[model samples]
Target: MASVLGPLQPIVDMVTSPLFLQIVLFPGLTSIAIIGALLGWLERKLTARVQLRVGPLYASPAGGILQMFADLIKLAFKELFVPENSDAFFFIMAPTTGLVLGAALVGLIPFAPGLQIANIEVGLPAFLAIITLSPTLILLAGWSANSKFPFIGGLRALFQQTAYEIPLWLSALGVIMMAGTLNLAQIVAAQSTGWFIIPQALGAFIFLVTSVAEMERLPFDLPEAESEIMMGWQAEYTGVLFLAAQGPGFVKLYAFSALFSVMYLGGFLGPGFLPPLFWMLLKTLIIIVLIMLLRSTFPRVRLDQLLRAGWTTLLTLAILNIGITYLLVVGLPTL
Candidate 1:
């Protein structure tokens, strides 16, 4: 068979490899696209129900489950044109790269035993570092439009990310201190006695807040405020470019929610009767719902107010949480 197959054998072997499946199928491009689409429908359905209305219908016969797919198709089909004198190369590439980075964040997350796409030792920090690049890309996308509104939006993106990013890192700092490991899988292992949420409740709150801000959910959605900035950084984007601009948020939502589950809720740990994957997924879904609910209820905040909260209030809380963590580690070394 080897003699007959020759060069084709290695291609088959590569296709069959678990690494390929992990990257191209489960936790990579295909899964990210599907999950991001489904999550869009979920968010709409959840918000609609909360506000007492039928959300998406007619896209799919069953509960409009295919609405997002329909929307994606529509977006792809729409005609679009680039602004004159704009840096068209970056105007198109930035959002596409942001979507890829969003999927890459999921690559580091452990969904179940033996299910991680890349179980790097510094998975936690690497995830943060990769995601931080997203806003920079957004800034690039906005600036590349070569228009007044987008330039302002681009500046806002830079400022907003700069404000919340530190608190985000500090919030996770307590997790690192408690778990005493940078590897996400090992962090889950450290929660064998109890979840980090109990001791690091304050940090978890800061994380939840910062995560919502980082994802630019309402109240934190100043950069692209539809009512104010006419969609802000994405004003000039249309058709597939528009799709690229919008898609990353949902992907990031899934990745960030999964990361929260891993860091606080214990990645895939659960009762013997329930599969590890089930628990991980259920937790991730719950966090996703909570984020959607927040979107529906939280008032849009001013950029200055949001920045102040991030730098002063959230920063102080994050620092205080770290101090508490130090005391706990000193008093209860076994924990």
Candidate 2:
């Protein structure tokens, strides 16, 4: 019997390896979650500073480092509110689906050579596909709440998704054209000569803009327009459920920043003195800070303006970027 199964032993061992389980699933999920939480704190603190007010100072005076934790605890203890008319089942399930799907994407993202949880050949497509589902889940959550605010929020989110998805994918196509690979690991490796940002600057800018829209952060947070809709789709959620929903929102931001770092900024390609993981983390942090700064500085654009920018401005720019990249590929001297 042992001899009969010998041929499959390596496969089985690979599946059951402690290293794979730890490094891939556990660490990846934990790290992203922690980063996401910290980012939430940073966004609040920085935005407050920009607005000339203190942010979460009672939680931790230095910089409100524990603000997110305090918020999390408060959320955990709050009452779970469910409208009598709402579909309780889907209301409960929507946030869970969004959180899981977003977190799972981290597995397919490679931080550096030999450091990824999974190295799928079609990583970029897989990521795009997974990310596109998040808005649908948010829509579901909003509709399930059976409230006017949430329903409106869901509709806004759907429209925002429709508006931005095209340019987002088009911009990614530019990167794919330049890198000549959809696999993120190969994409990062191609940057060994130089980061793609230098040549693909337009594509990077398109991506950054679309990614911010995707994140639904300030200036693009029309879906959750507090002044207009009052917390939008998450109005009814309370306790841990609300926290869970917020968790995935931040995770999406972190994952996108990580992907941007890998695709354009040279993932983990620092000097020999630093480890690959350190370099990757540093790059991701910088991107996140930039995002935070943008959130602090900009006012939310009107919905009509957002639509016009996405359709006219970003789409045109992305198309031009692709054409330029193609020209450079054909015209540049061979190495």
Candidate 3:
């Protein structure tokens, strides 16, 4: 085995070496951002399909693949309209803050075996900490905008964040309990026999649901409900600022999906025929698709219902999941 791995070791090194950090960071960020923007386009197209309407077909013949790019270009060159009443500093700061923080999270996640930018011992906790700041940034953006719609959107975002963060962290604790480590790579390795989805099925379910809420996708997207609040905190943003804010949403989705893949879907594990990076991307894409599907199928829930589901239903389920996993781990003998 040592001899066989000798030649292959260099390949691994080449892929994971420090010099490739730029390669990993840029392509990874670009790919994730593109996927997320595409997800928005996909959601529109898919929702249109469901509702029997055409969606953005004129942008490009290849089913509007260039639509997102076109939107990006437009947002880039379009003039930024900063409201007269707005606090120019934070108004300028908020969207970029959200985007930067969201993109920073990608650095902490592992893509495959020996393929990660940083592998801190407290990686999971670090990821949680980084993501928890998003809502505040949105709030700042909304408040700084000094507009009624944006302020209301900011308030809604604050409430939504408060409600969902608890369940999200609790669900994460369930995985921690089962895995016995905070390290993401270790957690992934612990699933050699079977994915956590089987033994901790309930936790996995809660995690998925709460994570979607955390991502502010459909059914829990009260913060940005257009009819109620006119795009919520982002109502005042336009042009590059709008694009920056939009960028974070995708980054967050990619980060959370990657984290979920690590926690439950046997991250980076696959047969010899396929590379580890391929497996990791495959798992992340699967989760992303499921999220998109949920967005397409479910109607947006009322704010009160969203709160109830998060605090009552999801919290109860996550707690029970941890209890059961604890009992199983304690009772079972080592093989």
Candidate 4:
């Protein structure tokens, strides 16, 4: 038995290495994808209940929890169709780019105490930069289609993300100011005294709204408005191509929810009864539910209204929050 197992031991050791486990298992790509799928079902179930309909129930006999996995399999087997006029290379490359960048953002987030992939000093900025990658991919996805509606939707994506990103970065600056560090794990530790939400409520609100726009979620989902633009930027995608384009959006939703929990909700810091990961996940789930509720609750905003809110309302509030946070950080020490 020892001789038989000897040859495979190195492979097993490599698979069980700390770096490999952190990158592939807990708080990694697989975990994020699984959680994203589960959240998708939860979103559907919640929206259905709101609309007085019963959501997925037959596929697995357990309220159709397996629906997402089944759908992924179906999409994987279906033919990928690229439009005759489309730029085949970029049309294929765009979604792959988005998925990779979105997953990269997960690597920056700390799941629990001593459970982060990398502990860079500039973790927050690294995260923000990785998030900004999506809009460029969105533009590519739309442009590669070589169609009018997709072109327009891609422009809208650029405009919307640009408008919101400033507020998102500035709002995060408020937390950074309070915490006095750009390291995410350190920021969570700072919150051992108190969560940033209490002092930076306005900034937190701005971050939440802008993140919705960044993710192109409901009420701010102008880039993919099905009724207005016929699936918009994703119109030319089919099968696994469609999945590649759409999967990142849900992953970003989960990523941003976790970001919010870590930044403003004290992250993994919580009561002793549960593991830190559990507390972190609970906070993130609450944010996810709140985000999903907006899907069925509100009508999509007009482009002008959406842009105006981002430029005028959110930006102004974010700036004010920064000033206020600066003052509290500077003044509170004297008392």
Candidate 5:
């Protein structure tokens, strides 16, 4: 028996390795999917509370916590409907692309020490590049539908992402300057002295606001404004394709929130009470709750207003943040 099992030892070790666990279990697809589903239910429940109504109670006995999973199951079994004149290839590819990119971005994020899938040197730039793919995929999704509303929605998405991505990149320069490395782990390590949120408050604010826009949530959800555009670029998708398209947004929300925690909230650096991963997760949940609250409390803004704010207000703030960071790092020498 020992001789027979000796040859399989390497395979067993490979399967149970930390890297494999990181990729398949915690801080990976399974965890992200669970979190996304819970967030969906949480958003509805919280919003319903604010609106003074019961929401999704019939889906499960436990305050409708299982509603999102139920919906996903229903969607998976439902018939897939393709538009008659739509470009079938792009239509199918669009959502798949978004889901892939979203997962890739999540994989890059370091949840805790030695717990990341990728720890590239140019992580920040690579992250920004991956985020830019979302808008392009949205455009493809809308245009491939060959419908009026979806096309309009795609154009709006393109414009919105283009406007906000500038400030998003500029805002992170403050952290990059202070940390002096694009590697996320190094950035977190540098925050041992203090979290960047203190001195880089302006940049942090810009990042928070632009992250909302990046995820296309609440007030920034002009592209998918259901009241005005009838679900916008997602109008033509059904069944699994719809899941592939819409599911990534929630995952991206989690990814962005985690990124925010890492960049500004000091990643996993905390008192040694629970664990590094626990602290990271706790901070992420707090940010997620804040975002959900924003969703529940705020109304969607007009496209023009969104554009103007992104271009003028956000851009100016990002510039000021960069200047302030430069002054502090260069003049003070202690930052």
Candidate 6:
């Protein structure tokens, strides 16, 4: 019996290891992939409901819940297709890098008290910095395709991301002011007295609008507008290349929604009945649903309208929110 137990000790140790569980399972590469796939299904099912249709009923016995997993398997075996004269290296690398960046965004978020894989002191800044890299990659993919439409699509993405990011950063600055720390976990703890959404409502609104733009969804999805440029910068990708190109959109949605939960919805703070992880996830899903609803509800805006709103309207509102937050932060002691 002792000899038999000894042989399995290494297996037991490896399974129980903290790094393995966190990095490979929850809030890591594998989890990111799974969640991104499920979220794709969720979007379709939800959009179908909006149009008075039943969604995803065939892939599995229960409402086609396994449809996305099945799709993932199919995509894994799909062939890679590159354009005639395209630079295959960067064309392939761009979307893969987007997937990695999406996973990296989750690492900075604290799901529960002890759940963060990496707890950087300047977590907020770190997340903002990493997300900014996504647009450049989009441009890279479009240019590497060596086609006019894709290059044009990539340029649109570059312009869109550049226009909106200023407002996004400004809106987040309000949170940094009120919380008085860039650490994400500490921000959650600071909300013990009250949530930031109450005082920072304007900032949250600006953040949501800008975030949708950053994710390139719905009204802001000019880069991949099917009718206009035939999937835009994503035109040349097929099979697994297409999956790699598109998977990060869902992954980024999850990451951004989780960030929204942490900053505006109080991270993992909730009533004691349910566990902390449950509450955190609940908030993140709610945010995800809200964003998805926006995708279904809004008409696609022209690029000019999008840039105008981002630069003028959202930017103004963000600055105003910052001013209000400054007053709140300084006046709290007096009150």
Candidate with top lDDT is: 1
Model 6, stretches more than 4 Å misplaced? 1-15, 332-335
lDDT tens per residue, model 2, 1-335: 26556788888788778656645455477677677778888888877888998887777757778889888888889888778999999999999888888787777777767877878899998998999998898899999998999899888899899879999999899879888999999999888999999999999999999999998888799878888899888888888889877898788888888999988999889898978888998998899889889988888888889988899999999999989999877776667
Ranking by lDDT: 1, 6, 5, 4, 2, 3
Worst 10 residues of 4 by lDDT: 1-10
Q: Tell me the tens digit of each residue's lDDT in model 4 across 1-335.
A: 26556888888888989989999987888898898788778888899989999998877979988888888889899987789888999999999989888888888888898898877899999999998888888899899999988888898999888689899999999998999899999999999998989998998898898899899988899999999998789988899999998899889998899999999999999999999999999999999999999888999998889888888988899889988988897875564
The deviation in Å at residue 103 for candidate 2 is 0.5
Q: For candidate 6, what is the TM-score?
A: 0.94
Residue 164 error, candidate 3, Å = 1.4
Candidate 4's TM-score reads 0.95
Stretch of 10 with least lDDT, candidate 5: 1-10
Candidate 1 C-alpha lDDT tens digits along 221-287 = 8779888888889999999999999999999999999999999998899898999999999999999
**lDDT head-to-head 3 vs 4, winner:** 4
For candidate 2, the per-residue lDDT at 29 reads 72
Q: Write model 3 residue lDDT over 211-279, tens digit each, in one string.
A: 887777787777788878888888888999999877787678888888889899988987879898888
Q: lDDT, candidate 4, residue 12?
A: 85
Error of 6 at 118 (Å): 0.8
lDDT, residue 280, model 3? 87
lDDT score at residue 189, model 5, on the 0-100 scale = 96
Stretches of model 1 off by over 4 angstroms after superposition: 1-4, 332-335
Score candidate 2 by TM-score against the native. Answer: 0.91
Identify the leading candidate in terms of TM-score. Answer: 1
The residue-level lDDT of candidate 2 at 162 comes to 80
Clash pairs, model 1 backbone: none
Better of 3 and 5 by TM-score: 5
